[model samples]
Target: MNAIFLMLMGLGAMALGYFVYSKFICEKIFKVDPHFRTPAHEMQDGIDYVPTNKYILWGHHFTSVAGAAPIIGPAIAVIWGWVPAFLWVVFGTIFFAGVHDAGAIWASARNKAKSIGSLTGDIVGNRARSIFMIVIFLVLLMVNAVFAVVISGQLINFPSATLPVWGAIIVALIIGQLIYRKIIGLLLVTIIGVVALYAMIYAGPMIPLALPDSIAGFSARQSWIVILFAYAAIASLLPVWMLLQPRDYINGIQLFIGLILVYGAVLISGPEIVAPAFNNELPEGTPSMIPLLFVTIACGAISGFHGLVSSGTTSKQLDKEPDVRFVGYFGAVGEGSLALAAIIAATAGFASLADWQAIYHSFGQGGVSAFINGGANILQQGIGLDTVLAQTLLTVMVVLFAGTTMDTGLRLQRYIFQEWGHIYNVGWMQKAAPATFLAVGSCLLLAFGAGGDGAGGMLIWPLFGTTNQLLAGLTLLVITVMLVKKRRPMWYTLGPLIFLLVMTTLALLTQLKSFYDKGDWFLFTLDLVVLAAAILVSLECTATLTKQIKANKASPATDQP
Candidate 1:
C-alpha cells in the first residue's frame, strides 16, 4: 500500500471531524454560548487568566497537550503494524479525542475554569475529587519527569538539535514581548519568529555542541535533566503571556511546517508501506496488542492528560466559550495529525522490510529516535533537503514540543499543590515559589531517587499509558455527568468513557500481574494505588449519575449554563 492512501484517509477523516462532527457537538451538545462570559474574562488576571485570541490559545493548548507522546506512542505502537495504529489515530481522533478534548474545555469554562480535578468535587463529590486529583498529579509527575529524560536523550543523541532547541526559547521570549507588549503585529512577529527558528535549525548542523560527562559530577544526561527541570521551574513561574503562550504558539506553527515537509515529501515520493499490515511474527516478549495498542497510542487517540490541560490552563485563557470547539477539539486533531505523521514516518521511512525489522526487534524500540531518523530520510529523499539539516529540523521540533509540555505540566502540577494546600490549610504550599519547588522537587526525586540514573523518569513510564487513559475515562465521566444534568445528549462522551475505562482496567490488571511476577514491588504498589483509584472514582461518578437522573425525573429539567 502507498503511504498516500493513509495520508489522504487520515487527513480527510480529521477534516470531516472538524467541519461536520465538531459542528454538531458544539452546537447541539455543548451549546456554546457566544455571549457566555469565560473565566478568562471574569477573572481577568494578567498572570494566568488573561483572555487570549482563539488562535494563540489554540496554539498553547495544542502544543502543551501534544508533548512527545503523540510521536513516541505511535512510533512504538507501529510494532503492532501500521494498520492498527493508523486506524486508532484516524477514527479515535474523530470519535474519541475530539469530543473528549472539546468537552473538557467546555466543562471547565462553564464551571469557572476549574481544573478537571477540582471540578470533580462539585459535580461528582469531594471524595472523588481527592482521588481524581491524586491521579492527575501522578499523571503530571510522570509527564514532567519522563519528558525531561526524553529531551535530555534527544539532545545527547542529536547534538545538532541543541542550538536550535535552546535558541527557540530566546526567539519565543522576544515574540512574547513583541506580541503582548504590542511592540509589533502578530503576523510580522510570527514571520520573524518562525524565520529565526528555521535559521537556527539551518545553522544547528554547523555548530553541534555536547556537554562533558563530568559536568557538576553528573553525567551529561543527568546534567541535562537537572538543567531542563530548572528551566521548567522558571518557565512555570513566569506569566503565561510572557513565555508559555508565545512559545507554544510559535512552536505550533513550526510543527505545522514540519508536518508539511514530511507529508509533502510523502506525496511527492509515494513511499511504500514497507511494514506489514499485521505482524504475524511477534517479537519474543511483545504484549498482546488488544489493550496495549489503545494505551500505547493514548495521546494520538485520546488522553486523560488533555483533560487536565484543558481544564487546568486552557480553560482559564479562553476568550470565548465557543472557542472550545476550535481550541479543544482542533488541538486534539493537531496531535492526531502529528501521530499520523509518526505512523507514516515509522512504517514507510525504512528502505525494506528486513531493515524495519532490525529496528523493531523489540517492543519499546523505535520511538523518538526512529521517528527522527526515518522522517529525516523521507525529507531528504522527497525534497532533496540535506539529511543533516532535516534531522536537525525534526529534532528541534520534538525538543521544543516536549520542552513546552514540561513547562505546562510543571505549572499544572504547581496548581495541584496549591489546591492541596487549600484543602489542608497549608499557607506556604499555596505560594507560587513553594508549590513550584514541591513540583520540581517531587520530579527530581522520582528521577534521581528511584532509578538513580538520569533516566529515573522512565521508572514509572510503563504505567503512564494505563494511568493516563484511566484518568481520561474519569474525565469523560465528569463531563457526562455535566451533560446529564443539563439534559443534553451525552452518548458521545459516555461511549468513549466506557470504552476507555474497560480497556484501561484490563491493562492495569495485566500490568499488576506482570509487576508482581517480576518482583518490582514499587511499581506494583503504585499500580495497585492507581487501580484502586480508578475503581473508586468510577463508583462515585455512577452514584452521581443516578442522583442526577432521579432528580431530573422528580422535577422539570433545569438547564445550566
Candidate 2:
C-alpha cells in the first residue's frame, strides 16, 4: 500500500472529526457563552493571565502538550504494526483526547480560570482537591525526569542535534523581543523564526557541541543531566512572555513544518508499507497491546497531562470563552496530526522490511531513535537532502521538543509546590526561590540519587507510561465531574474515562509480576503507591457521580455555571 493513502485517510478523518463531531460537541455539550467575560480579561496581570490571540494561545498550549512524548509513543508503538496505532490515533483523538482537552479548558474557564486541581474540590469534595494536587506533583516529577534524560541523551548520544537545539532558543529570544516589543508583526517574525530554525538544522553538524566524558568529574550524561535541570530551573522561573511563550511560538511553527516535511515526504516518496498490519509474534518483555498501547500512546491519543496544561495554564490566558473550541479542540487535533506523522515515518518510511524489523528488535536502545533514523530516511529519499544533515535535523527537533517540555514541566511543578504551600499554610514554602530549589532538587534526586548509576532518568521510565495514563484517566474523571456539576449529560467523557481507568489499572497490575520477579522492590513499592492513588481518585469520582444522580432524582435539576 502507498503511504500516501494512509496519510490522506488520517488527515481526512481528523478534518471530519474537527468539523462534524467537534461541532456537535460545541453546540450540544460545551455551549460557549460569548457574553461571559473570560479570566484573562478579568484578571489581566500581563504575566500568566494576559489575554492572548487564539492562534498564539493555541500555539503555546499545543507545543507544551506535544513535546517528544507523542513522537516517542507512536514511534515505539508501531511495534504492534501500523493498524492498531493508527486506528487509536484517529478515533481516540476525535473522541477522547479532543473532548478531554476542550472540556478541561471549558471547565476551568467556567470556574474563574481555576486550575483543574482546584476545580476538583467542587466536584468530589475539598479534600479530594488536595489529593489530586499531590497527584499533579508526581506527574510533574515524572515529566521533568523523563525529558531531562531525553534531552541529555540527545546531547550526548546525538551530538549533531546539540547545536540546532540550543540555536533555536537563541532564535526564539530574538523573535520574542521583536514581536513582544512591537518591533515587528507576528507574521513576519514567524516566517523569519521558522526559516532560521531550519537554517540552524542545516548548520548544526558544522558545529556539533557534544559534552566531554567528564565535566568537573561528572560523567558526560550525568553532567548533561545537571545542566539540563539548571536550564529548566531558569526557564521555569522566568515569566511566560519573557521566554516560554515566545520560544513555544517558534516550536509551534517547527511542529507544523515538521508535519509538512514528514507528510510531504510521504506524498513525494510514496514508500511501501512492508510492516505487517498487526505483528503477532511477541518479542520477549514487549508489552501486549491490550493496555500498553493505550498507555504508551497517551499524549497523541489521550493524556491527563493535557488537562493540567489546559486548566492550569491555558485557561488563564484565553482572550474569549468562544475561542476555547479552537484552542483546546484544535490543539488536540494538531497533536494527533503530529502523531500521525510519526506513525507514517515509522511504519512506511523504513528503508525495508528487514531494516524496520532490525530497528524494532533493538527496541530498548532505539525505540525513540528509530523516529530520527526513519525521519532522516524520508527527508533524504523524498526531499533530496543529505542523509547526515537530515539525521541531524530530526535529532535537533527531538531535542527542542524535549527541552520545551522540560521547561513547562518544571514550571508546573513550581506551581504545585507554591499551591501546596499556600493551601496547607506553609509560609516558607510559598516563596518561588525555595520552591524552585525543592522542585528541582527532588527531580535531581530521582534522576541521580535513587537512579544511582542509571542516573540518566530511566529510573522512573519503566512505569511512567502507566502513571501518565492513570493521570489521563483521572483527568477524564475530573471532566466528568465538571459536566455533572453543570447538570450536563456526560457519556462522552464518562465512557473514555472508564476505558482508560480499566486499561491503565490492568497494565499496572500486569507489570507488577516482572517487578517482583526482578527483585526490584523499589519499583514494586512505587507501583503500589500509584495503584493506590488511582483507586482513591476513582472512588472520589464515583462518589461525586452518585451524589449528582441522586440529587437530580430527588429534586428538579439545578443548572450551574
Candidate 3:
C-alpha cells in the first residue's frame, strides 16, 4: 500500500472524529456550555490558574501530553505490523483518547480544576484518592526522569539539534513576555517566534554544542540529565504565561510544521509501504500483540498520562467549559496524526521488505531513531531538502516536545505535593518553591541513585506502559461516574473505560509473571503494589458507581454531586 493512501485514510478518520464524533460528545454527552466560567477564572491566580486563550491552552495541552510517546510507541509497535498500529491510532484517537482527554478536562473544570488524583477522593472515596495519587506520582516521576534521559541522549546523538533546542527556550521566554504583557498580538508573536526558531534551526549545524565528555565525574549523558532537571526546576518555578505557555505554544506550532513536512512528503513521494500489513512470522521473544499493543501505543491511542496533563495543568488554564473539546479532544487528534506519521515513516521509508525487516528484527530496536532516519529520507526524497537538515529538524522537534512535557510534568508534580499538603496538613509542602524542590529532587534521586549511569529511569520504564494504561482506565472510570451522576449519556465514557480496564488488568498480570520469572524483586514488588492499587481503586469506584446508579433508578430526583 502507498503511504499516502494510509495517510489520507488516517487523517480523514481523525478529522471525522474531531468534527463529527467530538461534536456529538461535546453537545449530547458532555453538554459543554461556552458560558460556563472555568476554574481559570474562578480561582484566577497569576501562577497556575489563569484564563488562557483556547489556542494557547490547546498548544500547551497538546504538546505537554504528546511528549515522545506517540513517536516512540508507534515507531516500535510496527514490529507487530503497521496495520494494527495504524488502526489503533486512528480509531483509538476518535473513541478513546479524544473522549478521555476532553472528559478529564470537563470533570476537572467542574470541580475547581482539581488534578485527577485529588478528584478521586470527591468522586470515589478518600482511600481511592490516596491509592490513585500514588500511581499518579509514580507516573510523573517516571515521565520527568525518563524525558530528561531521552532529551540528554538525543542531544548527544544529534549535536546539530543542540543550538536550536536550547535557543528555542530564549525565543519562548521572549514570546511569553510579549503574550503576558499584551505588548503584541498572538499572530505576530507566533510569526516572530516561529521565524526566530527556524532561523536558529538553520544556524544549528554551524554551531553544534555538546557537554564535556566528563563533568564532575559524570559522563556526557549524566551531565545533560542534571542540567535538564535544573532547567525544569526553574521552569516549574516560573509562571505559566512567562515560560510554560509560550514555550509549549511555540513548540506546538513548530511540531505542526514538522508534521506538515513529513505528511506532505508522504503525499508527494507516495512511498510504498514495504512491510507486511500483518506479519505471521513473529520476531523471537515477541509478546502477544493483544494486550501489549494496547499498552504499547498508550499515548497515540489512549493514555493515562493525557489525563494527568488534562486535569493537572490544562484544566486550570481553560477559559471556558466548551474549550475542552478543542484544547483536549483536538489536542489528542494532533497526537494521533503524529503517530500516524510515525507509522508511515517507519514502515514506508525503507526501500524494501528486507530493509524494513532488518530494522524490526526485534522489539524496541526501532524507535525515535527509526522515525528520524526514515523521516529524514522521506523529507529529502520528496522535497529535495538536505538530509542533515531534515534530521536536525525532526530531532529538534522531538527534543522540544519532550522538553515541554517535562516542564508540565514538573509543575504537575509540584501540584501533587500541594495537594498532599492539603490532604495531610503539611504546610511546608504547599509552597511552590518547596514543592518544586521535592519534585525535582525525587526525579534526580531516581535518575542518579537508582542507576549510577543516569539511566535509572529505564528500570521503571517497562512498567510505564501498563501503569499508564491502568491510570487511563481509572480516569475514564472517574469520567463515567461524573456522567452517571449528571444523568448524561454514560456509554461514550463507559465503553472505553471497560475496554481499557480489562486490557490493562491483563497486561498487568502478564508483566507480573515476567517480572517474577526474571527474579527482579524490586520491580516485582512494585508491580504487585500497582496491581493491588488498581484493584483497590476499581473496587472503590465500582462500589460508588453502583450506589449512584441504584439511587438514580430508585429516585429520579435524587442527585448527588
- Each prediction's TM-score against the native? 0.99, 0.96, 0.98
* Residue range 1-561, candidate 3, lDDT tens digits: 999899999999899999999999998888888888889999998998999999999999999999999999999999988899999999999999999999999999999999999889999999999999999999999899999989999999999999999999999999999999999899999999999999999888888898899988999999999899999999989889999999999999999999999988987898999988988888898889999999999998999999999999999999989898999999999999999988998999898999989989987878899899999999999998898899999999999999999999999999999899989999999999999999999999888877778999888988999999999999999999888888776889888989999998999899899888899999999999999999999999999999989978887873333
Ranking by lDDT: 1, 3, 2
Report the lDDT of model 2 for residue 63: 87
lDDT of 1 by residue, 372-468 (tens): 9999989998999999998899999899999999999999999999999998999999999999999999999988876766788999999999999
Question: Candidate 1: what lDDT?
Answer: 0.94
User: Which 10 successive residues of model 2 have the least lDDT summed?
Assistant: 362-371
The CA lDDT at 192 in model 2 is 93
lDDT of 3: 0.92
Alpha carbon lDDT at 373, candidate 1: 92
RMSD to the hidden true structure, all candidates: 0.9, 1.7, 1.2
Each prediction's Cα lDDT score? 0.94, 0.83, 0.92
True lDDT of residue 142, candidate 3: 88
Model 3: CA > 4 A from native: 558-561
